[model samples]
Target: MIPKYRKQFNKEFSDEKYSQLKGILAKKGGIEPTFRISESPIFLTKEFESKLIDASESIISQIKTLPAEILQKAIPDNCRVPNDTDKPHFFTIDFGICRSENGAIEPQLIELQAFPSLYAFQKVYEETYCEVYPFLSEIRNPMSHETFKNHLKELIVGDENPENVILLEIFPEKQKTAIDFSLTEKLLGIKTVCLTKVKKEGLKLYYENDEKHTEIKRIYNRVIFDELDNIPDLKTEFDFREEVDVKWITHPNWFFKISKFLLPLLKHQFVPKSYFLHEFPEHESLENFVLKPLFSFAGSGVNLNPTIEITSAIKDKENYILQRKVNYEPLFEDINREFSKAEIRLLYIWRENDEYPILLENLGRMTKAAMVNVDFNKKDAIWIGSSNAFFG
Candidate 1:
């Protein structure tokens, strides 16, 4: 992170300017973000940028050659989602700064998700960021509007009417991250339909559009298998194992195959020692480890401070992972001359024919709390919530 510009940004920063920036984002596609937006965008130096890219690419290369048998073993025998595509369409690698044994700061892997995050909304948010600070345009944008648009078209609406492709979510409007769904609809002309609303008839799926039933040719999935278990009584024809006649832009099985489930398989300098909780031998001194539920999202079910009794109480050990907690070095400067440790999410988009997942964009969070989400910190705070980065 650059210190000089960060100081300049703080000196020139105003609540009025931030409010205007939020207004600009809200006016775009006519929707306001439900989550908090940070007061500053992170500024990454060239050295830090290269380290991040190198770490991500190295992990991706290793993942490509991983045997199918190993991945299958990672998924629960009964919980495997059918129609496996083997490759994830989207993923994010989260990195946190930590001090090495030699007292040097290094980026350590926190967790990675094969699931789609706030893909559509982050792009619009970056544009609003540039609008607020034109001087920051020299910084490299990991994702371009043109490339992102074309990629979305290729994956979601390829050779088909945009209306025929739908973003599948469970009660999307009620979800905290639903703003991305609305933005996706606005940008790509695709509609958002809940899983329970999908009508399955004779192996074909359809959703009502303007009271006319329209055939669904492709699905941009946003539903999580973990979430489906809670709503077992809901009436819907949605079944991952049903073998419906449809193309999944991001297949459901990949969500299980390439998630925290795959974290233990990955060994790199940037990654920490992570083990499946059930497989880990006892008396492992969990004081330095974090207990994480494999399938939860948005920092849910992650224990920074774990007790022996708490770990022992978990009945489903296979559903958990014990990761060595990295000591987060506060890198991003705040108004009080104190820095807040940050978590950087490097986002990627894998195309149909690409050799690897393309680095699309990033989400940066600087927080005062033990964790780094809007839900964990206050909005009016000095440095916290969702943020962007200025590279150059």
Candidate 2:
């Protein structure tokens, strides 16, 4: 973090200014986000940003070298989808800023996903910050708004008509990320439709638009297969497992293949030591390790401190992973002298012809709690929540 920008921004920050920021976000996004918006954006030095990029590339290179059989084993039998793409179109890797054994600051890998994230809203969020704090515009972002928009449009819409492309999810309006869906439509001229709304006729899928059946050509999938698999009574006209006419942007199988299930296989300085519960070596202490469900989303079913008894009681040992806990440095100092830890997610996109996924933007989360998740965050906390990073 840059001390000069942090000090200047904190000096000018006010309750009234934060209120105006919220108002403008609601106006621009067409709805208030259900999650907390942080009071400040972090300023990162160029050297730190380069380290983040290097760590991500190292992990991705390892992933590319993995045997096809290994990737096939990563996906569960019940979760596989037909016609998966050979490569993922999007990648989001999270890194916690921490101090190394030598006391030098560095980034540690937290998790990585081959799924699309707030590609539309994050750009708008950063631009809105510039509008509120005019001095922030002087500091360049990781990627320009124009270039980000162009890449996002190419990935989601491709050469297909915008009308035929839909952002697919289950009960999207009821989800916490509904604000992103609304902004995606406004930015790309595409529609956001619920999973239950898709109508299937033989091999093709369609959704109603203005009381007429509109054929679906592409799907920007946001549905979590684990969540969908758990809903026993849920009904849908088309199943993701079936062979459908629409093209998937990233393909659903990549989610399982590139998630925490693959973390143990990656060998990188930035990546923490991880192992499947069933394959954990004998005599390794569990006190410094955290238990995680292999395919769970958003920090769900994570045990911060695990004991041998807790790990032994599980019936499905293969479904969980024991990861070394990361020591998050309390980097940001607030006016009250309280400190908050931060993690940055590097957002990448791999085009159809690219050699590998390229980092384009970043999303940051700050918290005073043990995890960066909202469930662990204190309600009255300041300068803590969802934020963006400005790299100089």
Candidate 3:
């Protein structure tokens, strides 16, 4: 985080501008963002942007070498399917990083989700960032909102009609993050329906609209199998892997393809030394690393400072990983106000037409806690969760 920009923004901060931001988000159905939207966009020198891009390339390269078999083994026991066929298609990676103890910057793989993230909403936020704050003229946000929409259309629909594709999720209306799914519907003109609502007529999937049925040729899947176990009564006629005929935006295998399991395999100065807990060499001094459940979402079941007894309690050590912790420097300024520590989630979208993934969006998460999770975040914290601010 750049201190000069933070200081300047805090000096010129106005509640009226923040109110306008709230109005913009309200129109888009976004929760009012709590973090400060700077008067001027934070400028990233080419050197800094290159470092971020290099870090991403390093991670992607490491992911390429990870064996599919290893990922199959890492699936949580509660969510395991007989074979890979039962898995949801595709995954998006979120990287969390800060300047490491060694003074060089490196990333820590934070959250991995099988579900769709706030893709479309992020685009809207980007535009709001530009509109509400006009001072950001020198810095580029790196991601373009329009390009993101086009990329999703290309990735999900290809040459097919958008009507045939469905943005699939489970009990979508009841999901906490349904606002994002709604945004996707508005942007792509695709229907967002629940798994149970999906009907099977021969091999194709269909959903009813205004008492009429429409075929589902492709699915932008948002269901997480782990969450399904929580509600057993909801029945679906078809299994995702066995009988579904639609194409997947992210082929289910990639969820396992790009995950925390690959963190240890990546060779980068930014990546902490990681090892499968089961294969980790026995050491009395195990306090140096943090233990994380391989497939858990958010920061669930992560022991930042683990005790030997807690480490010993791990039933399937292979299902867990130990990563060296990176201290997040609280770098944002609020003019003697509490500083919200932040992590930048660089979002990339891979399209069929493109040879490589496109850097589409940059998502920022802020918290007044020691860590960025809900548990660690301070109460009444102004900025938390998904956010985008102008960067010239």
Candidate 4:
């Protein structure tokens, strides 16, 4: 974080300005986000921004080199979909701020998800920030309006018709991430249909749109195997592996293959020490480790400061990972009292047959609690919520 921008932003920040931002977001995004919106965006110096990119590239380099057999081992057989895409179309790399042994600020890998995130909403969020803080226009945004819109269209629809490509999610209107779904539909002209509404006849999938059944050509998937496996009532006519005549924008297998499953295999300095619970050596201690369910989403089954008894009680050690807990440096101090820790998620996109994924944007989370999740943020904190980044 840059101190000068923080000071200037905080001095200029007011309750009215925040309210205006909130109203503009709800109007422009076409839906109010269920999550918190931070009062201030993280201002990044060129030096720190370079460090974040270098750290991300280092981890991605390792991910790119993983053997095919090992990658196959990461996805559960039950969750594998037909017609694997061979690579992820979208991925996000998360990093937490930490202090090196020399006390200098450093970025440590927190987690990675080989799936699409708030792609559409991030563009709106960035634009809203610039509107409120006009001076921010001088900063280099990770993605411009044209850059985001063009890349998203190419990935989701390409040469195909937008109506034939759906942003697939379950009960999308009720989900917390519905804002992104709505924004995606707005920007790309794609439909956001609920899983239950996808009518499957023979081997083709269709969704009723404006009284006509629209054929599905491709799916920009937002559904997760973890959710589908857990929620029994969330049934659909077509299973993900039913050999349906539709292309998967991002293959589901990558969700499990490149997630926490790969963390244990990575040996990067930025990546914390991680190991499969079942394969951890006897010399390793559980006191400093956190237990994470291999396939859970949104921090569902992560047990921070886990004990040996807790680790032993896990029925399937193979479905869990033990990662050494990395200490977060409280990097942002509010104008008066609240303190915050932050994490950055590097968003990337890779089209079919592309050489590699391109970094499209960056998302930041600021929280005044133990974890970066909005659920963990204390309500009284000023800068505890979601934010964007501006690089000088």
Candidate 5:
């Protein structure tokens, strides 16, 4: 967070400008972002941006070397490969970085999900930000929202018909991120259907709509197999791992491939040393680390500023990890309030023809509390969990 930009923006800020922002967002149907949208977009320095990219590359390389067996153990039986074609499911790894004890900035591995992120809404949010606040001449978007949208379309649809590809989720309406599914449906022209609604006849999967059943050729999976396994009554005929007619956007195995468990395996100045709680080495001090669950969303089971008693209380040591805590240097300096730490989520999409991951859009999260998760955020805090203005 740069202080100069904040001062200037705050000095020029007016009630009229805020009104205009709210009106534009409302018109674009972004009044309710599935996740929280902050009051303002954050501006980043070029130096910080480069470090973020380098840290991401470092983690991705570590993900490449992970053994297939490590990943196989995490996949559910329904999604596990039988004897061949043991490909992973489609998913992305999100990292929250902060400056560590050494003065260098490193990434704190956050949740690794086996489901689609807020890909569609992020594109829309960026576009609407630029359109609504065009007067901010110094601020420029790093990636165009249109390009991100097209990139997602290409990745999800490719040469196949959009009708054949359904963005699959479980009781999508009941999901906390249902807004993202709704946005994906509006932009990609793909149906967002529940898993229970899918009809499996023979080796093919189809969904009936308006008295007609359409064949499913590809699945942009958003179901978390771990969560799905908890619900007993939900019935679906086909198993995700078994041979089926549809292809996965991200095969299930990649979820385990790029997880928090891989953090200790990566070698980088920006990553903190992480290890399974059960395998923790005897140390003189345990206060330097934080405890996190292997698979949880939105920082559900992370214990920041951990103590020895806290570590001992963990019943499932195998499912927990102890990661060194990184001090988040509050970067945004303009708001006249308490200091808030932030994490930038660089959204990347790999299309069909693309060999490398394309950095599409970004979402920034700010927290006035001690941590970045919703648990630590204050009710009236400024700029927590919102899209940011990454100056190029």
Candidate 6:
């Protein structure tokens, strides 16, 4: 993080400007973001930027070399999706910018996902930040907004009509991240359809478009298998396991294949020591590690201080992972000079024939809590919330 920009932003920051920024965002998106948008965007120096790229690329390289059987083992038997793609389309790698053992700043791996993140909203959010703060325009995302939009269109919409391509989710309008869904539709001319609303006519799928049934050619899946499993009583006409005619933009199987389920197998300087609960060493201390459910999203079932009793009590050992904790250095300083812990997620998009996912932009979060989720952050927090990184 650049101290000069941080200091300058804090000095010029006022409650009025912050309100104006939020107002503009709400008007542009037609709704206020359910998640808090941080007061500032952290500026990353070229040196720190290179380090993040190196660490991410190293982990990705190792992932590609993993055996096919090992990757198949990641998907639960019941959660296996039909017609999964050869490779994931959307990839996101999260890292906590922290101090290493030798007291040097470094990026530590937090988590990685093969599913899509706020690809559409992030571009608008970063541009709005610069619109509010004119001097900070020089520090922008590595990929321009126009380039990002075009790439997204090619991946999600493709050659097919945008109307035939749907951003599939479960009750998308009710979700906290609905702003992204709305923006996705506005930018790409696609509709966000609820999973339950998908109609299965033989092997093909269809959704109501303007009161008329329209054939679904592609699905930009946003439904989490973990969430879907919890809603057992909810019935849907189309099942993800069944062979459907529609092509999955990224494919549902990648959600399990390239998640925390694969973290234990990844070896990198940025990645912390991780072990499956069943294979955890008895000699290691539980206090130094965190217990995480492999399938849960947004830090739902993470135990910061794990005891031997808690680890022993879990009956589903295969569903859990014990990861060594990394100390997060409070990098972003607020107006009061108080620092907040931050995590930077490098968002990537891998094309159909690409050797590796291309790094596009980043989604950063500043937190004063144990985890980056809003539930863990203090209610009155200002400088800690959803943020983006500006690389110069």
lDDT of 3 by residue, 109-203 (tens): 55544345667777777677657765543454654667667777877777788788888888877766676777788888888888898889887
What is the TM-score of each predicted model, taking all chains together? 0.95, 0.98, 0.86, 0.97, 0.87, 0.98
Model 3 stretches astray by more than 4 angstroms: 30-46, 67-91, 104-115, 142-144, 353-355, 389-392
Q: Which stretches in model 6 have alpha-carbon errors above 4 Å?
A: none
Q: Find the 10 residues in a row with the least total lDDT in model 6.
A: 137-146
What does each candidate score in C-alpha RMSD?
Answer: 1.8, 1.1, 3.5, 1.3, 3.0, 1.1
Worst 10 residues of 1 by lDDT: 74-83
lDDT tens string, model 4, 1-392? 68777777788889999998888989977889898999888776788778888878878788888788888988777787888767899989998877777887878888999999897887788889889988778885745688789998998898898989999998888888888898888899999988899999998899998899899989999998667877766667989867888888888888988899888988777788998999988998888788888888777878988888888888889989999888788777677755688888888998778877888888889887777887788898888888888877
Model 2: CA > 4 A from native: none
Model 6, position 381: C-alpha lDDT score: 71
Candidate 5 global lDDT: 0.67
Worst lDDT run of 10 residues, candidate 3, spans 35-44
lDDT of candidate 4? 0.85
Arranged by lDDT with the best first, the candidates are 6, 2, 4, 1, 5, 3
Q: On residues 1-392, what C-alpha lDDT tens digit does candidate 6 reach at each position?
A: 68788878998899999999889888888888998888888777888888899998999899889887888898999989888777899999999888999998888998999999988888888889989998888777757777888999999999999889999999888898999998888889999999999999999999999998999998998998668878769999988889889889888889999988987888888899999999999898888899999989999999999888998899999999999999999888888888898889988999998998887778989899878776678978778888888876
| CA lDDT scores, all candidates in order | 0.82, 0.88, 0.65, 0.85, 0.67, 0.88
Off by over 4 Å in 1: 281-283
